[model samples]
Target: MTSPAPRDRVDELTVGSGARLEELVDRESLGQLATSFADLSGVGIRVFDAEGKLLADAAQPVELISYLSTLKHSRSAIESTVSSVKNLDPGPEGQAGIDGVSGGRYRVVALEHDGRRVGRLVIGPYFPPSLRDIPSQLLELEPALDLDRARQLLTMAPRVTDDSMDRLARHARAALDVVMFSGLRALLTGSMHLAAVRESYRELQSKQDKLQVAYDRLKELDRLKSNFLATVSHELRTPLTSIIGYSEMLLEGIAGEITGEQREFVTTIREKGEQLLTLIKGLLDLSKLESGTMSLRKATMEVAPLVRDVAQTMAPHAKKKGISLQAEVEAGLPALWADAERLRQVLLNLVENAIKFTSAAGSVKISARLSSLSTGGSADEGGLVLLGAQRTAVELRVADTGIGIPESERQRVFDAFYQVDSSSTREQGGTGLGLSIVKRLVEGHDGTVHVEANEPQGTAFVVAIPLKRATLRP
Candidate 1:
């Protein structure tokens, strides 16, 4: 026999205490490869316990239950002979093959690695042991079955060389090592993936914190600027009052007679003082809007009457400048739900700016009609439908053939204290707060204000106010 001739030589592969022999199998790949090895062995190579309990078996057909049962009984004797070798350590204990009966008997090979008896393999179903000739048990199963024919079929198990069996056991051990290494690789991959995700989460959290901090700071600075303007404008009003009052008194010669030249200069002073007062008031109103302190007293009022009233109030100023001022309102317009005072202020401011900027003989027209809006907060221009009166809004546009605001300056003009032609002291002479105050007051009434170019001519200021304040509720 070309076998190892050393059934008991298994002292080298012991792992540790309390661990079972099956733990030595690499669980992930054990099922995959054991079947392949069984096919190559060419034997009924089955693993079983000392008492013949089946563990794993190859070369066994599923349909042959009766034959399998017969084999089970036959394999026990083989297992018994293999178990005898378990007592010896790491060297040849004994030979376990059956003596020639019908032909050659099966061998029960005790499997050992590193001096530990791990399991037993039945390389058999061949011939019976000569010691128990014919193994009387087989004949007893069915008297009619041929003993000799059965014996011939049973002995056809693989006849591996003894030396080759030892080599095969080493092959099985090497295959298990490869499977265990692959398992380690999978574990490493999973660990790396988990680490990457954790790192990404941490980086995102850091960036979010920075953005939140920046936003809060910007909000704080904006509020501070509003408060500053409110305080400064209030203080300025007290002094401006005396200047305008005394200048008027001087013009009228209240204390004594005055020369024509003196009267003319005093009148100019009084008028300029009043203009300063208007600018100061605009600043205060804008601050109120910015600080969210503006109060709205809403009423249901018709749009046509308001349009007529604003244009009439602004007519004299427009006429003096030789600018044609006109009022146009959609007849039978539905009433508006609005803060009457704030709405009036918005229209008046737009008209004043139109009349003030337009040159002689240019036209300034104030028009009102229903406008529909598709967006909330009135932030962007959108598809809008005017409903009963106007479901969406009333757009009051003051169009003028004036020096049009540059595209870059249009958005900036609505910013507090910002203007297109502003210097330390501007030549046009109105505090730059007019449009800013107008914008804030409009928004306070749940409306919006912006400027556009009067095509081919000058600028148009558009004020769109919602009939109902639905965006923010108390």
Candidate 2:
């Protein structure tokens, strides 16, 4: 005949030495099981864990054992039997027995689960049918014993055959196996869950460490790039200034008489040189802004005058391009706390960009008015206006009828070196650093700048500066 299939088993290593009998099954449930079996079988029962801690006990008072306890020598003999029973090892067959002092016997049965012994059951102090009377050993220890009374007490003990007691012990062990199996399943489930959570946390922590390292590396690279730009821009400025000054002198015939073509060539050289100088200056300013080294000499200044000055300064360039330039300043506008020169540079850059993109017939308008600035929401939504109270600010709008910027590209316009028109053949000429510089300059004064579509056509660049002076970062 074919052998029965081997039972499925759990890995002993996974449970480890930490698995305990008491943890697998509760004492209250074990006590109830012991009580029920003891009541029905007329046998005393006790349960203990692997560590020898008594978990449950259910035994009816035996008159014989109680009477023997009154005699000093008999009580000593009884205590010795109880101690031996507690330390008894139920060997490979899983059961053992010992004789008590009162002619009763005790059975020790091993409790096992997953091929490992977790606890033991003690079924004890029950008389066997073969023992018809008290043993001579009990009388030898207690010579003053009343024979009649001792005999009466001996009859009170439960009597059963050896085969019957073995069967009862087997049945009780089987019932306990069910409880232990259920408890083991629960214990294993909890252990596995805890292991899984710990593993996930370890993986997450590893990824976070890698991300932090990458972030720190990027910051260092950015610092090095800023330093390079500052050094190169400073070195190029002195030579560039000489080139511009010489070209201007040559165009005015300072280098002796020159032909008409030579004059035009000299003029072109001067103009291009000036443009290069402007780009280098922009790069220097950007480096300073990024490194937080630029200083602002802030003072209370009127917005109306600043707006009119920007329009006046750009009028000649706009007229040359046949574009109408105008400034609309509201009367009695609040004074602004800002650096006059930096603010002028911001206005000039915006107006220049407007004229560069607008057609000959288009108009450019610079307007200044008193407005309420709200510091409440995210920068992308609009001004910061969602979470803070309204504060009085000077709002300057540089609107122009130029080729309008697309909605998708508006937010990116303030990024350094980014251009809406990046093709080689694009009409406008710029280093694309103007708006970036403008943004930093305005922010230095605790202000905000943003772009929107001009009504009907073109684009509007808005700058809002709060009236109050804030401590500026270097």
Residues 1-474, model 2: lDDT tens digits: 222221211223264234567877888889999999989988889998877889999987788998888888899999999999999999999999999878989999999877778889999789998898889988887897888998998888898788998889989988998887787778777666666676688889999999999999988999999999999999999999999999988877888989999888989989999989999999999999999999999998877778788888999999999999999999877677789999999999999999999999999999998786766665457554466766678888999999999999988999999999899999888878999999999999888899999999999999988788352212
Q: Once model 2 is optimally superposed onto the true structure by TM-score, how far is the C-alpha of residue 308 displaced, in angstroms?
A: 2.1
Q: Give the Cα error of residue 120 in candidate 2, in Å.
A: 2.2
The TM-score, computed over Cα atoms with residue i paired to residue i, of candidate 2 is: 0.80
Output the lDDT of residue 177, model 1: 49
Q: How would you encode candidate 1's per-residue C-alpha lDDT over 1-474 as one tens digit per residue?
A: 122212111222112221223444443344445566666654345554334445565643321223433564544543454454333232364235553222333455564444545555555333222333344654564455456655554554345665565556456555644654455455435444555666688789999899889989999998888899889999999999999989878877797999999888888888888888887788788778778787778778778878888888888888898989999987655677777777778888888888878889899989988775444433343332222233477788899999899988898998776778877665465666778778878777667777889988999998877766453222
Cα RMSD for predicted model 2:
6.2
Candidate of highest TM-score: 2
- Candidate 1's C-alpha lDDT? 0.64
